[model samples]
Target chain A: MSKNDKKQQVETTGHEWDGIQEFNNPLPRWWVWVFYVTIGWGLWYTVAYPAWPLLTGATEGYKGFSTRGQVAADIAAVEAQNAPNNAALAASDLATLQTANPALYSYAVNAGGAVFRTNCVQCHGNEGMGATGYPTLSDDDWLWGGSVVDIAYTVSNGVRNESSPDARFSQMPAFGDILSNEEIANVVAYVRALSGQEADATAAAAGQQVFLDNCSACHGEDGKGDRMVGAPNLADALWLYGGDAATITQTVKNARFGVMPAWSEAFRDGGLTQAEVNAVAIYVHQLGGGE
Target chain B: MSQGDTPLYAAREPIFPKRVSGRFRNLKWGIMLFTLGIYYLTPWIRWDRGPEMPDQAVLVDLAGRRFFFFWIEIWPHEFYFVAGLLIMAGLGLFLFTSALGRVWCGYACPQTVWTDLFILVERWIEGDRNARLRLHRAKWSLNKLRLRLTKWVVWLLIGLATGGAWVFYFTDAPSLAVALVNGTAHPVAYTTMAILTASTFFFGGIAREQVCIYACPWPRIQAAMMDEDTITIGYRGWRGEPRGKASDPNAGDCIDCMACVNVCPMGIDIRDGQQMECITCGLCIDACDDIMTKMGRERGLVDYLALKDETREREGMKKTPIWRHVLRPRTIFYTALWSAFGLAMVFALFVRADIDITVAPVRNPTFVTMSDGSIRNTYDIRIRNKNGEAHKFVFSQTSTERLWLSVEGSEARVVEVPADQMLQVRVYITADAGSPAATAERTVLRFWVQDLESSERASADSYFTGKVR
Candidate 1:
């Protein structure tokens, strides 16, 4: 509107569209210079880096930078950071490390947790709480010893832990071989009473002598059996073969010893170290009920 | 007249783009060769990813829910990487559009390149533009019959190759190739090939320029992005109008050659001014330049220029060339946006992780109480192993009373996860019956997993329900 404003160099083309006019203004000064700079830079970049596709390959740029090299450097940095912890795990005894160093024990536990999910979680639960037949580690009761060392040994050798005749050797013999049918019936009644199952008083009393003579050798007179022999304590009320009349009768007659595969073979085959297993034991103990 | 004033009822004419040759044509051919070569060959390339990972160089294993690209293995949880890649591609398009108009559509678009290739085969068998036009006009001949049959055969072959190469990206390429050759590929593979073949033939061989003009949204969007300064393939009307025969005393520089129209792939006369169908491939410029040399006139009768310059020159005003208009505000804004997005994507990749966890609250009876006076909640936790090696995860929780985690079946707190597998199990968390809120209160708990050797820990949060005391 002003004379000075009208003197401004910019001009709009005379031709007009609906309501719009084309400003015949020159591009911004900064924009033009930057465009030139980038064009120059692009030329340099093409020379210095891989830009053009060749018949057989690509032209190697002068700078020699590569995504592969960058990735390799990152992996190396991570590896360097992990070196010390890896060494510590390789050197220490699992049980001692767990009891002596909480940090190291925790690391092992964490490691073992990962290992468990990978190898053992399919059969065992994710947290090592056993399914129907699988034993739960979060309880005070343990079939094998609950001590870290005891657990390590059990994991290393396994239950029925032997490779031969004496492997962790423990079994309850069949009372049916020596006792009469009536006597076996009475013993079954007495065993039920030990587990607080109902039994006729007369039947249990009649079986007492037969139990004392035949069963009391491994099972104490009180029916608190030796754990060393794996003869479970009857009074404690945890039944391995089950406290039912039929199962008890069958167990007493045939005797029962379940095979627990040796953990050493599994350990070696699974590619787990002894210390790693110890860490898992300590982690299992921390699950709440270890003595 | 302004574009809006043009008659709306004007019938649209079908275009059969005639083929051309020269710099841009050769450039398009080179791009097609390289892109199709990579597409067909990449799946067969091998990578040494040790023993646990897939060896295909580029593969999307859907059943495994993983993607393998050379040394990089992507787990399903890390799908953000793929999203980031798509963002980068979009940004790349913006950058290219700001700098060079429709370069992507002209040289790199899959549709344009393939259609051009198919058209080349058609021309090779049926002859050039004029000959084909003349043949269509003439009565049926044995020569014409043979040419048409040959063209169809070639078009089908190209379609089959394009479709056959696509399935290789989804599975082990070499093994799948053997299966295909032996007639034992999966039925799904056969179905995919059939579908792709039909689409390629219909789109690239038949539809051609109709896709660029009507079927695509890009041309409309690109029109919005352009400003007065934007360079499009244009005709210099000042040098072309006041039309007369070439030999007339008043004849303008154009010389009525029509060479530009003959060479256009979209078959539009650049001299008629910019149209929606121009791909900006610059073939018309090459053709018109060649014509100008013969007529002994100044070149660029049809050229790349802005609407403002074209109008001003026609009105006899001195024109400011391309360099003067290169630094506009729109160009600067687009450049800055593209750079910022690219940098953000790089930063995100650095912080992104390869590990993830999801917790599911038990559906049936969410909370349970034990005989020993403890309140318990059950959850089915699914832990995914994203790395290449198997790992163990230890579970722990924090609550009012010391919260104990028991895996329903296993005896160990350590859950071992196989590489690239999801481990699911029911976990029971119990707090002593003496807790402050014994009946029902939400308690926030944390589950942490530490890699035994690396001591790296990952944690997730979930709530446990208990009876209020």
Candidate 2:
């Protein structure tokens, strides 16, 4: 009962260092039980989940849980939930989309933005501000058209590609084989003059008659390129290729051939679905370009 | 000592503090009523925040990612205000602890308040100290079982109410109360209530002072905040020494009465001097004062005394004034720091603009050469309207050189932003061909959005990239 007697009764570990002796005290019973419970939980967890790696794959535990499988299931669930909306989007008329069904229009735009970022960003840029060769979708200039229906058709069939039979097709003869170098140079001067760039006036006047003789069929008599033929307007400041004198001369000689692949699943393998095509077309149309 | 017999842990010895009445005890009761009343009643108070917002005076709307306190609404981006408040709370604790010792631990701590309530319930059902002690040691009988079950049920109800009051802070109190009674609340709500109830019951009713001594970090931290001038409860060993019966003329003013020990919540003998286990609740002071009055002797045998004052009093010198103990440099510094944070937060809250704008220029294909020979830069401009009603915002540009500003999807450079919503629009700033801005590699520009209704405006500075001509 005495304090000194109680101190003397306490046990110490058999080892001593200098005058210090380690007390041989037991851990708290609750802590010891919790440690045992954790060990049991670890064994159960290993049995219930994929834990060990085998020769070809990991062990398929009782629960058959895999993070990869879980992620795939989650994606599938979301896709299934959106199936009705996607179906409605594919069937909705693009012209009446904004007025008749605003919710569907908003959904299409958001969905289309996602699709465009994944597939079209490489050439069209993140905000659809096209690169030098690619046509900018955010601008008012359009070679074919800029309407929602027009954009949808262009996106589905593409331009001058062999993948789709209905692809917008246009061909300009390589005038290099017919016209002399002097004649090609004069026509380049006339084309530059049409776009309001500095050019040789005499050579441009001479080339105006030559333009009427050959290029007028596709480029129109006024040098305003026809959209039906998918010809770019020479008078516009936008150019698919460079509008400098040298670049103009090269274009008049060899002509330009831009090929866009079809995006519809019916036209190519691993292509976009009808809903995805509509979505992307709506997304591109809303980028300030659609007329 | 033998190697196998040493004990590392010991079971807790339960404390049964007998009730006492005095000035400090009355103050503690008043504080308990005020704090508990605020906690249980705050969520039920309503304020008019218009029809579009929740009316709760205080709400943590996790679903909306906002904290609504009276007229102030905090967005996630304004989390620094909450952080400032928390820092102020910490400094306030430091100030009080350095000035008056563990006053927070003794009177205002949630653990102390709830434990006091639980002990009151126990005393009501099982009788006070001696009766409760007898009940604890007696063999299990029908009468004991009835009393124990009654006490436990009341404690459980108090715990339930504590947990129930907590959830009302997150949602509308009346609706959540209805849903709770109808068994229609969210499963998470039920789960949170259950968890809080269990913790309250265990910590307040069962663990009591053990939570302060073993679990809480505040008691350990308070040691660093206290110095010689800090006022704390202590036994006047100089006055009450040579303890004996009242009739003993040789004894000092001290009759060896155990009243102080009997009323201590931590069950420590105050006559043994200051120890870390003492929360300084002053219940012992109350008990000793009552005993001293009965014996017709002077009181303050156990009282709040500073370490320096103890030494001065022992040497027969006058103790310093109470204000001298409180107005020291450390407490003043903590008070100043706490006030600075509060004032800064208030200034920021009042000066914050209702409209916020951010401009992020498209980096890939930084500048586009338009068909008209003009240079164009695309920006993803986000405008946040914090107003209660929609307003049309006129988008304009200011630059050193001439530039044309246009908003996508609108003919005029105007956008109608919905109230309390953020709208992202594609903005185009174009420089005419051969213009100074077009020829420059980069042109500095400020994009401004002015509310058409109120003329309130906000601007963000961004640079437009041009083709290096």
Candidate 3:
């Protein structure tokens, strides 16, 4: 390289003892311009947004934008979109709601999936498989009734609750005072035969008249049970009290009444809207047995 | 320029940060892999917490105000556990810094890791130091534009991922991922992503070293924490001075290779002295050693050494042993302080209660007289249930006045409270009027609540009163 070609336009720090040399050049033009632009941008940002904290809160800047306000607006927008389907769900009856609007039904089912996971998964298994005491919602047989209206009614006004006037109330009588031990055993045999389970033929034969005289008032003579009274159908495989002989005998001797505190009074008195209850009922209904 | 202007020293130029390879680099790579891997994978793991609770292994349910780890579930009132974790982190940082200077800052700091990642992306798209410098000096071209755009896209994606991972800590990760891809994630997620993306671009991409040197308080605080005995990345002036190139055969051991300057991320020549921007990352040591090996010179031109030992060597004092300097009074004190805080936090967390109570008295009209010659007072009581079941809160006050307490709105004394919900009730207390005297008598009234089935009893206290009779 020629000496003139190496004439350094920018002088170095000149104390270089090795290949490393410090250039005394000014800052690059683009970098300095960008630095200025950034400063200007910072000022603009401070003025246009709530950047500084004040004694009360933050300054309401020119744009008046906030993280909270933005979030609220976004949530409202999404809710507005879902409002029509929610309205349709509110207007229709439970049975008609499912069949009339396919889209709404699909949406409700999807919505119910999460709500069930949140609320009903505790006692009723995650998938609505019953535990020892908890009744399964997935089966066709129900302690109450399986019809959509019946299911909805039972859910709204739970069993054995005096607060709701319409709750299907039936408590098996405590026959300890009325019937002898032998009679209680005979009745257990009669109940077993009614369900088509194993039973002593002779005792069941003698106990048929006893059931006709006492149990037929709530439970029909055919043992089909009165839905209004919430007596279980003795003919069905499902047993509300129990199928085992010991449990059956004990139940007959001293009644077994499981209390489900009224949910309607709680929901109504608690000031929750019908839509909210319906949302929850529909959620619970879909857990196992919903058609 | 005047003599005063030229008197002291030159402002340090940016370190061109040359690349190097060694055992320390390998260790750093290993740690980076392990930490980043854990962060990305931890959210997807599931735990079978029965059918009742959420299944995500590690989740912070913001709406539920519950934190779920694999086995331990934390409620809002039990926030001491979180505080304990933060305290442990602080202590751990102190202990680590006391042993090795700025090691955490150099390697594990989020800023450092992200900056390293940004640098990698920059290198991939814009080429390394010399190539970048040449390109910058060159006029703008279509090729340069394409490279710059590609680099920005990658950087933005990394920023989005960072924001994405952060939101996962607040919600269920897999569900959020699905929601995000389906455009169903909360708008807050998008906003957070934007903010994070901008920050990553500014901090990691542009203001890299400025954050460490001028903005961060850590380097300033660390100056006070360090002492003469602390091991810092230092150039051995005793061996490296009288600097000259190896071509000049009579030069000192340094050979004036400039390898150290080339490899420093901050661009400061280590031979000048330690500066605030130096992260003590030991890259210079690696660079210097490589040069030394190539030049047939003994290594360690730049090494981790104590200031006292360096000074002693300069003053012709006998060289002190390495182990003697490590166990100083400052390190011992720091260790003790760190442990004390750690142990105290652990102790507090274990004993902290899940349930907390706050009682408010109706102050507008403090007392009233019933027609039956009884004094009455009203209280608004709130009960919160932390357990996963609806509980019955029974009302009975501790006043010996046969204080018949009854809730006004509900008939039954037993009130039902849902899981993780607070139930507020207005309770009225009445007593035989003539038996109580004075307006401001302080009598502690106890309210006991039992989970009827679980037999778990929780008690709270309030006061009973009557006007002067």
Candidate 4:
């Protein structure tokens, strides 16, 4: 058949655009059936799933499915699977946990890493590499101690905090009130010399007598620091609050007081569980600084 | 012409194609066997890849994130190889379509092959075209029900086998087959097989020509790929027109026997000139040639002919040679593009390293100050061992002589990576306080890992941050 003959047989929609008329060719029956099937499926889907929004909340359909509920269930399931391990880790002795049960120790370290990410990253950083004021957990320059037991105690009671009675407590009397500005400057030079930084030799010699009288009790006579009092070692170059002349002068005048929160739930509300405290201790200990 | 007469939808017209035998039909049969054989049997072929890797020569180990084909293994990071192959397949289709017309659609398409097999089964059970048509039009009866049930069961079985073969490509064939019989295979495997089976049966047995004409996009795209020199199956309207009986005085070669239409799987008339519905299967040419020979007429009443050749023949001029038509610039360009991708992929596969390393510097606290006033930067280095046996790799730095490398848990800068697995280790690079690298804001660090046994080294460059003061 010719094109004209076929065109004449088919009806036109009577809508013309730029002199081209639209043909009213029927769609395939299968396509129309599929369209109807989709409509039916959509109607069923609304009834079976949470679809409509109301004033209070979305309408809970027959399935009662919510993404929040799904995530909660997933977390609960994982927690249930690790319940035994968590219980064992919480009860194990921090000193001998690693050698007694290496598998459980390993599990605690991984689990503690997750807890540390959520609760400790703000101060300790993501990799436990601390900032200027904060002490790096991955290094051997811990002000308190690097042993797993010491870490656990610090994490449980915290440092110089009013919340826990057993918190690691230390107080440095601010010397700005008692000592003159010249004395503070001379002591700063002496402190810098102890850490092997450039210092005024005459001032450092004079400040040595002042340091023995004022700072030797907590910082030790040799300036090696005392772990019992959580005093930082002045013999090493690792500084928590900078080793510069200006910063050292400020520290000698007013002293530094860093407060950490007690992580054990026994001491504070919303604190980490016993198992979490144990895990984080193991994780921090394994960061290459554990004794 | 009336609005009321024009319905909004039209039903599909069922086609019962008559069976025909010729060189083209035989060629289709041979291609079907060859392609199907390769599909169903490839997964079962075994190659000894040692104890650490899979033995299947052709397998898509989705769980392991690897693609194994014979001697070559592809990791997930090398998915560009798969992309290159798909590009080559597309170019090959273009090359064939430009030279010959819908050759893939006619002879080698999975749809065509499966549908042909389904038709062969239908012919064997229903006694060919006329009998099948009569049976289709006849009212429901016990005999009709029996024949219909038998044909559906056979079609379903063929579909099952096709689906079964497909799943074997993803896993170990023998174990999966045993698990399937034991009803213990993964639910996903069962679900995938069921979906593929249903689709194969529906498209091959029932949908048939509708899939190529309405569902597939290739036929529409082929229109742009073909030009006047493209040889396509066509009826010689110049010679075959004015069709009449042999007894007529002024009759043409065609006897109006409708033999070509009867043999068409697409249910299209080749005598209507070129149409989109025709697959150019050459079956019509085969059928018409048989009829022309019996009538003592010259052959090629329906044959593969280019539009340009038709114009030449009508003008009483010599036709262009087949080589000239196939070797034109368009076909040559497509062939060259297709070959280039194939060669590039092969070269990449051969030159790929057995050990791969990637270093990601920890940037949270850019640099850490150690007790000794040294600046340390941490990196998470992932080493992928593609070898069949475990190998120890010694880590070292090629740049920044002041930088010292240390592994996290080891006393020495050495790590053991398991065979065919990727292991991540924490690496610390330290620069002494007096060194220039320790004071620079950023230093380019090139870390190298060498296999202790083979000494094959792979290096990755990363930035090392240090204290600015």
Number of the top-ranking candidate, with TM-score as the measure: 2
* Deviation in Å, model 3, residue B290 alpha carbon: 2.0
State the local distance difference test value for candidate 3. Answer: 0.72
Candidates 2 and 3, the one with greater DockQ: 2
Worst 10-residue lDDT window, candidate 1 chain A: A160-169
Candidate 4 lDDT by residue in tens digits, B30-135: 9999999999999999998889888999999999999998988889999999999999999999999999999999999999999999999999998888999999
Sort every candidate by lDDT, greatest first: 4, 2, 1, 3
- Identify the CAPRI category of the predicted complex in candidate 2: acceptable
For A197-259, candidate 3 gives per-residue lDDT tens digits of 899999998888888888888788988777767676777655544578998787777777776
C-alpha RMSD for every candidate: 23.2, 4.9, 20.2, 6.2
Candidate 1 docking band = incorrect
> Residues B1-469, candidate 1, lDDT per residue (tens digit)?
2334667664545444466566666777789899888887888899876578778899999988888877666777678778877877776776566656677887788998788788788778867777778877778889888887888788888888888999989998888889999999999998999889888888887778878877999988776666667777788777777666778878677777777887777768888777888888887887778777777888888787877787788789977767766567777777787778778867876665555667787643455444255666777788776677888877666655467787743668777787767777557787776675345577788776666545666777888887664
What is the Å distance of residue A153 in model 3 from its true position?
28
User: Which model is ahead, 1 or 4, in terms of lDDT?
Assistant: 4
TM-score of each: 0.60, 0.89, 0.59, 0.86
- Candidate 4 to truth, TM: 0.86
* Candidate 1 DockQ, CA atoms: 0.02
Q: Residue-wise lDDT of candidate 2 within A217-259, one digit each (tens)?
A: 9889888788898888888887777889988777878888888
Where is the poorest 10-residue window by lDDT in model 3 chain A? A271-280
Q: Which parts of model 4 have CA positions greater than 4 angstroms off?
A: A1-71, A84-110, A147-149, A161-186, A245-257, A286-291, B1-5, B316-321
Report the Cα lDDT for residue B237, model 2: 85
The DockQ-based CAPRI class assigned to model 3 is incorrect
Better model by DockQ, 3 or 4?
4
